[model samples]
Target: MTKSVIQPLETLRLAQYAVPIPCFVCGTDNMFDAEFCTHCSAPLALAHQADNKKVHPRLIAMVGPSAAGKTVYLGMLMDMLSRRPERMQMLARGAFSITLQQTTLAALARCAFPPKTPSEPERWNWVHCQMRRAGKRQTVEMIMPDMAGEALLEEVDHPHTYHLIRCFLEKCTGAMVLIDSIKLREGAREQDFFTMKLLSYLSELTSNDKAGWRKRPIALVLTKADQCRECMNDPAGYARTHAAGLWQHCQERFGRHKFFASGVAGTCAYRESMTEGRVQVPLRIEPHGVIEPFEWLLSELERSGKKS
Candidate 1:
């Protein structure tokens, strides 16, 4: 006697239920049936449901020459994102994208600078941050390639620089270009050349790509503003009077841009007294509007996404 064969569908009737997932933005455990994060109200793992789901997360590159305080600025920005009360609701959490992230963070924690060193050809550091704003959680990733001053100068003649620039520009939604105010004050001729070359390359990239690449927003960041109190006192006015030429150049090329001042170290100088042996005395480091540019970029992205 042949017994009736059980159907394959009937054999799988006792499948186990999938477990609830935790929110990537706010760490809230969400049931499999949930749609949004319960703690932060941000959509939990629902990129498919978002408007402009094809739109990639904005990449905010921090471009600057060596010793221009790029690493310090990043450290301070992360510090602000983690502790600033005003930004608490907006910031979710920040983490390093690679092993280098922790290394950089550790160096910053000690108020020491990164080794100013790279042993490999393709070394880079990146930080990934999840931010919440207007009931939406967006990720902001920053990429900083480890390049020496000499290497950057050589990049002008090499095709790799252009390749790197193109790769970064294609993925970026916005940018913050850091200019070393102290270097400018010291009359560094190399800095002037680097700035012009970098900007010109960016302009060419945007212009050649006629597919609306120029629409990406950019911010010209003047670092070490603490050394120039007069400039910090009236940042807008300073940009208009002193940075007018550069600003105009960027505006003509990029279509959307702004100028800003930032100082990561709250003092101007530091001195180690022999009498006290290891006691470090803080000098004139003043932090003024260091995070303003980033805040503006975030606002702009939020507005742009909302409109879409």
Candidate 2:
């Protein structure tokens, strides 16, 4: 009779631990089979993709207060870019990366925006894709996370509260700061304070002096500008006139910054639901000024540095 021998359990475990996978966000060592980063809870799929391509992807952060229209803006932007493919094009790197675009489009087709993003880093939809300009050969690998506004505020007020947000912001080279134009137009001091706090927090986090928040490019986007045509006509003037505090802060602290206005909802209606109460629904989809800020940011980092 032939006898079979089994490998030692300790040896098997040792083999499993031999190669360590470092998180792309937090740089924490994880088992090769880990599905999420232990430190920051970022998807391990990003790490695996990075390893497979042997390329470091640039990170951009989209941050704003709760109800700032981050979800709608991001969802609409991705859907438009992926479908239009006129000026610039984006090709998602992995299958998991397209979930945000897919879900957002599906919801929009039903005249509703995507639901609020979950606060958990692992649950959040991360956009991992390559951007290519018209007639350009080399593509830029980028990862953008749609972070929760509440989680971001919590981290800003209390450091390390959201390790994923903090670590992601610390490593991001650019940021899109979304301001609710509807609130600003109505003179909400709370909006001003929230933006001020976020900018100040970023200033402290990246105070390298030589190349910190001051040098990083920021696009102050006034979302929901369709409600007020004046915002779209002249974004800079709108900022200076309405959000004076935020405008002044950017002028003094940041070196490269610009103002933009974007609106995804063509028309809206408030409807009462039995279960969810009052909710706003989009009547139609008409994207405006959505691609300008993104294109400008990419241009600044890639070729043209518009420092104003």
Which candidate ranks first by lDDT, i.e. highest? Answer: 2
| Clashing pairs in model 2, backbone N/Cα/C closer than 3 A | none
What is candidate 2's CA lDDT for residue 276? 88
Model 2 lDDT tens row, 170-289: 898899999999999899977778898999999889657766788888999999987878899899899899989999999999989999999998998889999889998988888999
* Pairs in steric clash, model 1: 266-285, 266-286, 267-284, 267-285, 268-284, 268-285
- lDDT, candidate 1, 1-308, per-residue tens: 99999667754433322455654333456665565555544344332222234434455666667766676676567656656645633232223243444565666556654556442324445454455544445644333333344444455446354344445545566777777776665656555557667667666554446444467677777778877666666655665555555655665677767778887655533556576444422243345676688878778777666777
Query: How many clashing residue pairs appear in each of the predictions shown?
Result: 6, 0
Q: Report model 1's TM-score to 2 decimal places.
A: 0.65
Q: Per-residue lDDT for 246 in model 2?
A: 92
Off by over 4 Å in 2: 1-14, 304-308
Q: Which candidate is the best by TM-score?
A: 2
RMSD of each: 10.6, 2.8
